[model samples]
Target: MQTHFNSEYPSVEHLRAKAKSRMPAFAYEYLASGCFTEVNLARNTSDIRQVQLQPWYLRDFDGADQTTELFGETYDAPFGVAPVGLQGLMWPNSCQYLAQAAVDHNLQFTLSTVSTASIEDIGQITNGRFWFQLYHPAEEELRDKLLDRAWEAGCRTLVMLADTPTFAYRPKEIRNGLSIPPRMTLRNICQMMMSPAWAMGQLAAGKPEFQTMKNYIPKGLNMKHLGLFMNKTFSGRLTENKIAAIREKWKGNLVVKGVVNPADAEIAVKHGLDGLIVSNHGGRQLDRGQSTIVPMYKLVPEFGGKLKIMIDGGMYSGADIASCLACGADFTFMGRTPMLGVCALGKYGGHHTFEMLKKQLQQVMEQVGCSKVSKLREHLIAESVPV
Candidate 1:
């Protein structure tokens, strides 16, 4: 694929700055802010950056290959887009646009249960080649229906969220009136008007709704009712029984995201899960919790061979990805990084982000004399903090 990357915004920081300028205060805060003081959010990236790598400048080198095999498919890169709810709210049609970009670039994209795009929409866009992350509903009937729809759409991997046991205490969301039953204040409206690109895009896309759950939602309901309905619909806390039930119903690959402890990982393996995404919900759910990387040093060693030990949280660049890989993460995923790309550049933003990440990872591999994705551990020089 020809590079769609913008040289002006070569890094995540640059893209974020551009995104901040283009987006409304509420929208940017929704995408970028975390719960409480955002201690873990900042720590997630800083901790990963602390990991040092040893370069092998003189080693007999074969060219670097970023290709990685997860579950059954080989990807051009080891990282894929992490599932983000209400993607369209940040940038109109972002959920749909990212799906198309992932298809073009041969990378994986996971659609959140509450994401603005429907399961069928992403299924059609990726041609049945996407992952569905279920935010387990309160009703068993609802769960079954969602699983059946995903199966019919040709989705193979099902990611059950183990974190987000409750509604987050994000101060930004509260201040922005983005908590359940989102209220559009005059300030929000004025800010949107100020952001011409965002205002125009929202007009074109229409007001963002939960497309996947629209069928279940009653028609003509006000924002307050819709928020109440959504709040009652999802259960949030995932239990062993819920996992077992879903395992029985879902025939394809099953992965549990937001796992940070070996005990939780042991349960995932016992329940016959295919993978574990070591995450703290990108630090959205936890304020004082350990950054996702810290647990990887423990989880990867114990559960590495048993199941695919994937991770997502605070990874901003290829070097951050290399640090996680060196710590034994089988694959990586990012929500804010790719979202920053889309919010910065609109339509081709996803393609550019994927391409940039691949290029950065390629440079890291060549610099460290690591040719394949599987052997990055050899380049691990030292950990920033002991587990």
Candidate 2:
């Protein structure tokens, strides 16, 4: 698998720096900020980095392969693009670019419920293979309609977000007026003017909107009313009854995202959910919560074979993916890093970031003398590693 990435930006950090330079301050801050003090956000990456893998120096070895299997489908790599809302706001046409890249590279691309691209459009782009993340609308009818739309568009996996019981109080977003129904302040306009590339891209792609939710929203509503409509429309809290209703309605692979507790994992199993993405909303929803890796460490041992356990939050590179695998995650998803890639290089970012992560993961596998993605657990150095 040859990755045609730019040599100058080889690492995700490089991509992040470039993305920051390319995007407006408000957009970059919204993409980068976590809740409150961002303690958990930093911890998600730092704690996962604590996981150590022992390398095998002398062995009869073949080249490493990164193919992974999940939900009866095979992916070229163990990692895929995690869903992010308002993706086009960060980089115009990012949703389409990443979806096409995912299809071309044989990876999963999860489309957020509020993403700039519509469900049907992304489904067409991925040939019905992309996963759709649901925000859980307040009305049962609306929820059922959204599910039906996803199913009709050929989405087989529905990632039900359960972490955002309420939107996090992110200071950066609040200050920038980047919250729901984002305020178009003069300062924001000035900032957008500063980033011509991003501004021009937005001009070409048209204004970023909740394309998936637009049909349900009434026309001619002001931003204030729109915000109120969004607030009333999406009820993030998830109860067992709600899960059961979703299970009855959606006849697809239902994954409960934002699960951190072992008890919740049990509840998911009890409710007949297919998988659990042990996430803390990428550390955006909860500021003081435990790192995603911590819960993953506890959950995998308790329910490894009971249900599929995937993880996301602070995963930045191939080594990070390898770390999660060594810690017993079935598959991994990355959000900000891939978005940063696209923001930095526009059309090239999608394939470049995907290939970069794959290349890095292949290196880790070779270093650990593991050939298959599932065998990454064999390299875990459990004793000396600090969680």
Candidate 3:
């Protein structure tokens, strides 16, 4: 497939800067800021860069293939777009755009339950090939309803969120009144006024809502009630019983996200989960936790073959993906990187970012004398591994 990269924004930093400028202050802060002091957020990316891959300069090279096999299917690339809630608020139609792009790229796109787009909308876009990340609704009836919708729509891979037991105390969201429908404070309105592109797009696209849960929301409720309703409706904490129940109901691939340690990983394995995503909720939940890269040194050797070991969080560049693979991650995912792409370049932003990553990863593979993505661990630098 021909790539659609714009020479002007070759790297993630360039796309991020452009996105920041084009987006409103509240929206940008929502997308960029982490909880508390953001120690974990910064640590995630910083530690990923610390990992090094040794290059072989004089070996018979057979080029490189980026295709990855996962969950009984082969994907064009190993990495996919991780689920990000409020994606439409960051960039209008970004959720829909990304779903389309992931399909075009032969990659996975996980849709969050709180995302602006509904499950059916994405199902149509991906022809039921997309993955659905359940937020674990409070009621079994509600959860079963959601699972039924997803099944009818064609989602075979269900990602059960295991990290967010409660909403983190993000200072940015608190100050900005970042609810489902943003609080229209004078400051927020002014910020929106400053970015015409974002403002016009939001206006044209209509107000972003939790389209997946729209039917259950009470009618004639104000923003405060809506927020309260949302808080009461979905449960972020996933128990062993919850996992077992889902295991019984959903007859498809089940993955538990936000697992970083052995104890939590044990629960997934006990419940017969198909995979474990070593993530820190993009460092949005815990400020002092270890970077996603730090735990892989332990998780991989213990459960690598038992289940598909995937990862996400603090990944920014193709080299970051390479570092994760070298650290023994079977597959990878990215939240901020791909979202920044859609926010930076609009409709085709996903294409540009995915293409850039493929090219960048391909170059790394060829230069390191690694012929395939699965062989990336062979190039790992023993002394400088992620620890």
Candidate 4:
């Protein structure tokens, strides 16, 4: 395989196109679709496009610094990969591939609760460069047990997902029949036949399984039943007491994910969370919720220097990242974009995505007359009309 993407496909759209060609219709739909209507999904990127950069020219020529330090560790890039579930379904051993890429790039990679690989497995592969994302189970004992497993696996950071009270109504998944432990329907089989390379990879890896939940779920449940089981096993409810309980339980740096409101930011600080990610679940959860960047633009200033503000949503190009920095995010996290790159290009996906984003950022930095990413704020000019 060439293991390269087309020039036109530099952004996540490239991988998405490749993924659609490679994955079954059901699988592709599961990964690509957002909740009802996908209005918010489109809004995420559109909202980012609204912000224009004010570039300056003819400044002293010095290299820029993209390295960012958070909770004592320095990452070569300002952004890291956010967690996504069932990555192997998109591409075989996708979790391992992504984790290794993050390690090689000196970036953070978070493993989801329903991830195809175990935390320990990814921990070994990523060499502790991995973080763990938790889906709060209804049973306190089970929830605590899962957290303990993450800690025992040497995961240094814990990201508690707070947005999912119930699974969002993703129309594509329903129409595609994306149940747990996927079934090979005629529709799916036809779709899979279109992409021989992707089919071969899955055949080579055997079949994808939720490695983390293997110990928890009963072995008899099929894919259709798996979705229902997940619905029952996880609780979507997020409460202040739960946050306090988790903070008390996890000794490492704890970050609350899916924050869109400044009031929630204050509550996170009140709960003593180490960091907060301003996200609308990448516009996958609430269709009417404000775009992640808009809230981040407003909330970061409100929280000011007291809290570490991170943004995750609609970031594609390095220019998008620079825009986030210019707006006020201390660091950014990308979920779908990097995964799309990896699944599309295999081993080199991480390299290409990082280079792509870094190149864009460096160019923006040079043009904007900013020597450091922290100084990007001076270039921000809020638009009177959202682009």
Q: Candidates' lDDT values, in order? A: 0.89, 0.87, 0.90, 0.80
RMSD, one per candidate, in order: 1.6, 1.7, 1.4, 2.4
Q: What ranking emerges by lDDT with the best candidate at the front?
A: 3, 1, 2, 4
Of candidate 2, the 10-residue stretch with the lowest lDDT total is 221-230
In model 1, the worst 10-residue window by lDDT is 222-231
Question: How many clashes (backbone N, Cα, C below 3 Å) per candidate?
Answer: 0, 0, 0, 3
Over 1-387, each residue of candidate 4 has an lDDT whose tens digit, in order, gives: 223334666767676787677667776667677899998988988888788777777667577888888888899879888888888887787788878778877887889998899988987887776789898888999988988888888887899888887777887777777765566678877887887877898899878888998888887766662346668788877889889999999999999888888788889989888888888887778998888788876677778687788888888888889888888889898878887887778767776787677777888888778888888887888762252
- Across 320-360, the per-residue lDDT of candidate 2 in tens digits comes to 99999988999999999889989999987989999889889
lDDT of 3 by residue, 1-387 (tens): 777899999999999999999999988988998999899999999999989899999888878999999988889988999999889999999999999999999998899998899999999999998899998999999999999999999999999998888778788777888765778889988999999999899999998988998898887556542236546888768899999999999999999999999999988898899999999999889898899999999999999889999999988888999999999999999989999999999999999999999889988888899988989999998788657
Query: Which stretches in model 2 have alpha-carbon errors above 4 Å?
Result: 1-3, 179-182, 224-230
Q: What value of lDDT does candidate 3 attain over all alpha carbons? A: 0.90
Candidate 2 achieves a global lDDT of 0.87
Q: Which of the numbered candidates is closest to the native, going by highest lDDT?
A: 3
TM-score of 3: 0.97
Candidate achieving the largest TM-score: 3
Compare candidates 1 and 4 on lDDT and give the better one. Answer: 1
lDDT of each residue in 239-268, candidate 1, tens digit only: 999999999989999999999999999999
Model 4, residue 41: C-alpha shift (Å): 0.2
